[model samples]
Target: ITDWKLQKEGGAWNHCSSSVNHGYLRAVIIALYKKGFTGKDIAASKIASKSTIYRIIKNFKESGSIVVKKASGRPRKSSKRQDRLLKLIQLRDRGTTSTELAQEWQQAGVRASARTLRRRLLEDGLVSRRAAKKPLFSRKNIRDRLIFCKRYRDWTAEDWGKVIFSDESPFRLFGASGKKLVRRRQGGRYHQSCVMPTVKHPETIHVWGCFSTKGMGSLTILPKNTAMNKDGTNTSSESNFSQPSRNSLVTNNAFSSMMEHLAIRQN
Candidate 1:
């Protein structure tokens, strides 16, 4: 304990990043070296390790200074132009996986590791993530959608406000179709935000609902195995709407399973 205190007071061994601190410690070690303190003796004092002390002395003898020289680290395998080419190749085919990108990069005369490729792409702000899913429309579907938009383009918000858009969406009774991520506070296990809400087997049913710009309408669950059509449950749903919204529109027309606007009326 007394020896350690003396060494610490003289110049303690500390983990330092700055060269100045290392240089000061090197000076202290050199001073001790001059006073005939052998490497084993300095190691015993625990001021610094025997290997570090020897290295510092060797450096001082060679450089004529207490400051240790810094060695250059491992060189980068890819050049700037090669990295830019890699980004271009990556952007050319976004769906290409890292493994596939490595192959492609190899074909272009650049042999880069998968980790190296990822690091380069990260530098370019291009990160790998799951591609979002979207419904692909046929030419006719596109034309129909465009026509529908054009037809309603002239209508004012008040004209559209009277409308109620209705649709039937089926939900899984057992569990969610896909996992949903929720941000939760600590110790909020029983809180509403942390709850994984799901309809139990009995309460689960196919619901038909109405939506409007003003507000929402009543929600009614359909009975099992009933084919919904314009003349069936959908027409009956008009009465179930609690709001005095006189207008009505049933998109995604049930008859054809196409986006067809129907029964849009203002009373």
Candidate 2:
């Protein structure tokens, strides 16, 4: 058997220069052999087996170079066209899914799997998919908005500010909070029982208020007993305070109360 010391020493010269020491292993073997080092001594260096060292020496005698043959493996799948197509898909359809883009590419004469498209898109610094935000309004909504703007063009800033804006909005105590893609399982209903805000008729009270830039006025929570007339008049059957139910009386009382409060604060 070859010794470890010779093999280790032989490997040092073998690893040094690939250009100058092109047949380095064979040169080491010959050099060591001439220097009174046996084949067992060369094998002991652990660089190569004794048989491998002999084979290298024989091969060098026949061929000029000690370079190993190139390896053979599966060729790369993507061509330049495929790479360009991936970049094009990434640039054009930023938030589109890989599956959707793959289908699109197939239609455009490039057949690729979703996995392939996903990998390529990732390599090209593009995400496979993303959440698409829901638009706040549509074309009809935009048209109605423009019409409202045009109609309110004559109103002054103070006039607009004096006009109190109030709208009813529903709030659920336990509602799902985000926009997410929901997938229905096998034999399962598409709808899940999530808390939805709802208002029962007669249970909900009507709230109205008026305000100006200077101050806010009293907010009125109208009871079900109060009747609203077609002429935009409030009529109550009974009065808690010593005030008349007539519209003029109510208006005058409210104006006097507001003015008196303002005067008292000003003093």
Candidate 3:
């Protein structure tokens, strides 16, 4: 026997362990055969099953080694480097379709199917998902939003609690809201393509509502083509009610004024 010893715990070739490497089994069988051990004696040594030992011995006699040779067949469509390029394309534009990605990747010197491209992206931890819808803001709008956030950054919860926030929105009565698909990795919630952009005003019925930390305040449907006056009143023929109080912190086109005028006249 050789000086090589096997650890009894969690080691193969010791007390009939099942996790024996093919090379190790082949070496053991050859070693035992050279030592004048019969096939039956080698089987009893517990290195491998009789069938496995005989097959390995036969292969060794014919090929001189137990290493598996590469199979002869068609080559892969995309190499590892090409697969990485596909991933880069996906990261650059998550909204790109698999077919589109395949088309783009062809320019990079690789021809592959869309399914294959998707598989490569999946292997790299990219998944196809519906992009989240977000309100689109212009550069000026974004700057104003940042300024607003910073101005109120230090406000306490109590201070915010007293503030009433209001907004006007339109809901489509007869139209489908389209959705977009995107491929993204984990923790990419804020990616540009991963978010759906919403316009400032969509063509639909305009409704106004206001809420506070205390509770909901008012809900009103604004009339179509209604315009505000210098006193912040909706100057439509339907909105001819009592004039607004001068003490009201009004705007030429403020939301609270429209909501209040609608609410008072409805009662």
Candidate 4:
């Protein structure tokens, strides 16, 4: 009919796919009725059932509007003030938990459920949780670090070039020594079973050396028998143990002896 073609062009029939837009069913029934189409014909057209079409026509004639009345249910717990309070909490204390926000709001005389606050915060574009990293040092630690910077400020280029930078780090032979699973919640107990049996492998050691502008020095592997005392002093046992065999060792020492042999050959 004329009305049916008009509605198809106006995109009114598209709303019928949604339960929330059931009001569009009324418009369809009204258009069919105005074109002198009977209930049987309307039902046969598959727009809606006979009873649904009748109800829509009756409601449309009574109310003059196509809006369906809201169904009765449990009312919203949060008021406008509570919504604004939720937004304020998010803006001021982002990444806070719903339970914490609920408790704080309760103390402020605006009692709301944690679930309600959480829903409101999400609706207001605020994420419910985040992982925050606490800084390792404080302002006092930063201020004290300036002492090292000041001590190195006046060094000449040659002095800076001669300075060595070295640090020690533990090397695990079997890879990482600790558990790898991460737990998100605080105080949550994690499974502590060892994934692999711990076994001692051949000990490995690394020594790195570097100078300031000239770049790194050659790496020297230390003997496994080498050990440092508790006070960082080298013990005599390690010194003697690191020495080469009698045949390889020279009285003049390898470094000076090699230099002398090279000089004698050049002469």
Top candidate on TM-score is 1
lDDT of 2 by residue, 12-88 (tens): 65676765554555566666666776667767775567798777656645665455556787664567777787688
- Clash count, one per candidate: 0, 9, 0, 0
Work out the TM-score per prediction: 0.60, 0.38, 0.49, 0.43
In angstroms, how far off is 152's CA in candidate 3?
A: 2.4
Worst 10 residues of 2 by lDDT: 236-245
For 58-163, candidate 4 gives per-residue lDDT tens digits of: 7777887677787899877777787887788767977667788898888667777887787887787776554655335466544444544455558787664443
lDDT, model 2, position 80: 73
The top-ranked prediction according to lDDT is 1
Native-to-model Cα distance after best TM-score fit, residue 260 in candidate 3, in Å: 25
lDDT of 1 by residue, 1-267 (tens): 245436456544344445656666677788877888777777677666778988888887788887555778888878898888899988898998899989988887778899999999999999989897745668876677667667777889887776667777776566676777878888987788777777545334677776777677677677764435666544655676655433356443622233433322111
> Which 10 consecutive positions of candidate 3 have the poorest summed lDDT?
236-245
> What's the CA RMSD for each of the models?
9.2, 13.5, 13.1, 14.2
lDDT by residue (tens digit), candidate 3, 9-101? 244445463445445666767877778877787777565678987877677678887764668889788899888888888899899999899
Give the Å shift of residue 100 in candidate 4.
Answer: 4.2
* Global lDDT scores for all candidate models: 0.70, 0.54, 0.63, 0.56
Off by over 4 Å in 3: 1-75, 175-203, 224-267
Off by over 4 Å in 1: 1-21, 25-71, 179-205, 213-215, 225-227, 242-248, 253-267
